[model samples]
Target: MGCSKKKIKYELSKEFQFEAAHRLIKNYSGKCINYHGHMWRVIITLHGHELDEKDMLIDFNELKPLKKWIDKYLDHTTIIWENDPMLTFFKKNNQKYFITKKSPTSEHIGEIILDKAIELFDNQRIKVKYIEVKESNTSSVKVYSNKY
Candidate 1:
């Protein structure tokens, strides 16, 4: 008899892009402290051991919510650390902004996106494996789920 191996894992990924501006609030002394913008690129991966009833890990349409959320909140907006001193200025000026608990670095942004993906796709059959946030063509950060 011949030994056979069975497929046990599957993964699906989707890429999205948005435009946003941010400035590092602290722990940096570079030009990043000043406001800047990037055409952000995000790639999210889903992992599972088995396919669903439709023989698919997940329908691509199921991921549309994530893209829509990003476009609505992160695109064409300034992402600022919650405690940044400029918060008052933005509030007073009525500027479009998104507040983050941590500095708006690529690493933190990746973590935030990953968290949102988990919230939107939480299920026993599949989970968010990782999220990669590319601040620029040359710089990017990848955040992995602790459950993985």
Candidate 2:
């Protein structure tokens, strides 16, 4: 007889957007001097250890709320690097916001996004084994389990 239960691994990713401004110090942008926002994209990956009765590792619907969290907080918010002098000025402006101790590169932002996604799976046994962040469609960085 075939085994009724199977242990299957499943992974799913969701994309979200945020708007924020940042400047790279000593970088070559003559007029990056002014604040600018990006149509930032965040991709969150979720992993699951066991398959349910449907032989599914995870239900896509279950991961939807993670997008909601990102949209409400990080979306359309100015993300300031911890060391930037602009931090104080943005605070003074009292605009929508978020703060980062590191430069707001896609990798750093990816970690923040990954951390939040994992929180949703807290009661589950599965882990977010990996994360990949893209600053532009052509460029990206990843963090893996070994780094954890």
**lDDT values, one for every candidate:** 0.92, 0.68
lDDT of 1 at 79: 96
RMSD of each: 2.1, 3.4
Model 1 CA lDDT for position 40: 98
For every model shown, the clashing-pair count is 0, 0
Candidate 1 stretches greater than 4 Å from native = 1-6
lDDT of 2 at 135: 59
What does candidate 1 score on TM?
0.93
Highest lDDT, which number? Answer: 1
Highest TM-score against the true fold, candidate: 1
Candidate 1 per-residue lDDT, tens place, 1-148, comes to 5333245788899999999999995788899999999999999999987778898999989999999999988999999999899999999999999999999999988988999999999699899999999988898888999988
Off by over 4 Å in 2: 1-8, 26-34, 122-124, 145-148
